[model samples]
Target: MAGQACLFCEIVKGERSAHVVMDAPDAVAFLDARPLFKGHTLLVPRDHYETLTDLPGEFLGPFFEHAQRLAGAMESVLGAAGSFVAMNNRVSQSVPHLHVHVVPRNRKDGLRGFFWPRQKYESDEEAADYAARLSGGLT
Candidate 1:
């Protein structure tokens, strides 16, 4: 099924632009514009799937695999202590496309609060390095 003007759908169709980190036949991973951390990335299936239930087993398998790879790349690039992967559906979903968030976390990043807070970047050079290093691993 085709998605209804969702950002992810646009991205999949090349109608939108993203700093794509990793992409396979079934799934695509890219940097999030509004990042929760230094190396926050998003993973989604190329085919339209509004939620987890809508994703076929075949597509779901690779989606997770690519997501895991992305997480590993983030760890190496950002020196993250760990990574967090999450997805929201229906009530919690801000976007209607089935997508997973891969957030890089460090112990001293001040994200331990109940609410996940975003910290300011000192410069774009830092953000660029984070994206470049992760993207390099994708190739």
Candidate 2:
């Protein structure tokens, strides 16, 4: 886990701006600035933990439960068939802090197995709209 210097940590601390989706007691979900799809969202712990091994045992269930909630939101709110929920322990982890990528997906969305093609929203407003919908689903 990185310290306060981590980018996600900064966002969690409100030092950085993110199109936040939801703020749970133990985790936070937000739209990915660089999305794999229009509704791609990231779920992370409020506290910093670099990799899976670093996460406390008590944190595991709630973390995945939140991820599942976000994934369901991707379908119900965004019209996705389902979601691609994943995390990289260390090797493919872009951020030092552990996070789950709850990417909305449909069959033949060009995501072959685990090979994802990165995408972007038309604008921040568009991203915010997605955030708002997913945020609402969290309620």
Best by TM-score: 2
Q: Per-residue alpha-carbon lDDT of model 1 for 14-124, expressed as tens digits?
A: 789776777667877777777888679889898878899998877767678888888887677667888988898877788888989999887787777457776545666
Give the Cα-based TM-score of candidate 1 against the true structure: 0.85
Candidate lDDT scores, in order, read 0.79, 0.89
Worst 10-residue lDDT window for candidate 2 reads: 1-10
Q: Model 2: runs farther than 4 Å from truth?
A: 1-4
C-alpha lDDT of candidate 2 relative to the true structure: 0.89
Model 2, residue pairs in steric clash? 1-50
Which residue pairs in candidate 1 have backbone atoms (N, alpha carbon, C) closer than 3 angstroms, thus clashing? none
Rate residue 77 of model 2 by lDDT.
88
